[model samples]
Target: MSASTTLWTDRPLLGFDTETTGTNVAADRIVTVALVHSVGPGRENETVATWLIDPEMDIPEPAQRVHGISTEHARAHGMKAAEALDEVAEMIADALRQDIPLVAFNISFDLAILENELTRLGLPTLTQRLGHDIAPVLDGLVLDRGVDRYRKGKRTLTDVLAHYGLEQDGRLHTADVDVSATLDVLRALTAKFPTLGTSSLEDLHREQMGWHRRWAEGMNEWLTKKGKTPDVNTVWPL
Candidate 1:
C-alpha cells in the first residue's frame, strides 16, 4: 500500500516479546517468547503463539521473581535453546516477509538477544534469513515517547498501559501477557496520534529509528554529564 493511503489499524500486526534470564542482551538467554498476531479494530482477530525455552543457564533469582519461571520448572518443561530459537526466528521471519509490522514495547532488546542466540546456535539471523534487516517494526515504547515527549514518569509496559487508561488482565513480565499489553498500548497510541495510524508501516519504522537515536543521544549525554559510562546503543533493532 502507498504510504499516504495506508491505515495501520487495518493491517495485521505481530506483537512479540521475550522473558530472559537477565537484562544483558549480549549474554542473557530467553526463558520464554511470545508472538501475538492481530488485525482489525480493537484487535478482535488475534492468534497467540508462545514458547518456553530451557536457557541452559541459571535463572537469576531476581529475573525468576519478575517472570515467576523458576529454573526447576524450566528445566522440566522447556524446550532446548537451539530448538526454541530456531522456531522463534522462523515465526518472526515469516511475519516480516509478509510485510506485517513486528510490534514490541522495546524492540531493540528482544531483537538483539534473539540475534545473539541465533548466532550462538549456528543458525542464520533474522536479517540473513530474510535477505535484509527486519523492517516495518512497530515499537509501542518508541512511538509513545515520540508522541508524548514531555510526559513525566516511567514508560514501562505497565506504566504505559496505565497512561493509556487500559487494564492489564494478567500479570506482567510473562511473554504472552506482555505481548498482549503491548498490542493494546499500540492501539491506544495510534488512536491518540492519528498520524501514527495513517502512516505506512515503513514510514513509521523509519520515524522510530530517528526517535530512538535522538532519545539515546540525549540519554548518553546525561550519563556523561554525571561521569557515568554512556551505555545506550544508538542503533535500532540491534
Candidate 2:
C-alpha cells in the first residue's frame, strides 16, 4: 500500500453505537443511536449525530437503568421509530459507501441491532442499501482481545478506556458517549500497536473475523468446562 493512501486510522471513521430496549437483537427495539464521523485523530475532527426513538414498546426497568431512557421519556421526546430508523440507516449506508470504516466497541451487536430495526420497520436494511456486505469495519473490542489475550479483567467500554490510559470522554451506555469513547480507545490501540494503524482496512477487517471467532471458540470452551451455556456469538459484524 502507498503511504499516501489513508489508513483506516487516519481516514474517515464512522463510530456507531445504540441504546436499545433489550439485548435480544431479533426481538428488542432500538431506543437510541449515535453515529460519529471522525476524519482525523482528534474529537475536534468529528461530527456526531444522535437519535432517540419511541420504540413503540415498553422499555423495561433493567434496560432503562442501563441507558437511562425510560419508555415514558421516549414516548414524550423521541422521534417515531420508523422515521428515525430510515434516516439513521441511510446515513450509515452513505458512510460505508464512501469506504468509511465503522468503528465501535463490539460492532456486531450494534450493527445487528440496527439491521434488525430496519428490517422490523420494513425499511431497507444497511446491506440492501450498500449493494454488498458491510465491510472494512474496525471493532475496537475484537482487536483489543486479539492483541492482549492474557489480560485478566472486564473488557467493557469503561474497562477498555481505562486500560488504555485514555480518560473517560463522558458517561457511557448513552449512544453518543459510547460511540466517541470507542473511537478514542481505537486510536490508542493503534498507537500502541503500530501494525494495526498501518494495515489496510481490507486486511484488518479480514483479520478481525478470524480474531473474533478464535476468541469466541476459546470462550465457549471455558464456558463448557464450567458447565454453563456458551453464550458468545461467534459471528463477525452479524
Which is the leading candidate under lDDT? Answer: 1
lDDT of 2 by residue, 1-238 (tens): 6658756687788999999999998899999989998988777898999999999999999999999999999999999989998998888888888888888998898889888888888999989999888987989899999888889999999999989988866778988889888989998998889899888888899999999999999999999999999988888978
Stretches of model 1 off by over 4 angstroms after superposition = 1-6, 41-44
Give one digit per residue, the lDDT tens place, for model 1 in 188-211.
998898888888788888899999
What clash count does candidate 2 reach? 0
Instruction: State the displacement of the C-alpha of residue 192, model 1, in Å, after optimal TM-score superposition.
Output: 0.7
Regions of candidate 2 where Cα sits further than 4 Å from its true position: 1-3
**How many clashes show up per model?**
0, 0
lDDT of each: 0.90, 0.89
lDDT value, residue 10 of candidate 2 = 77
- Clashes by residue pair, model 1: none
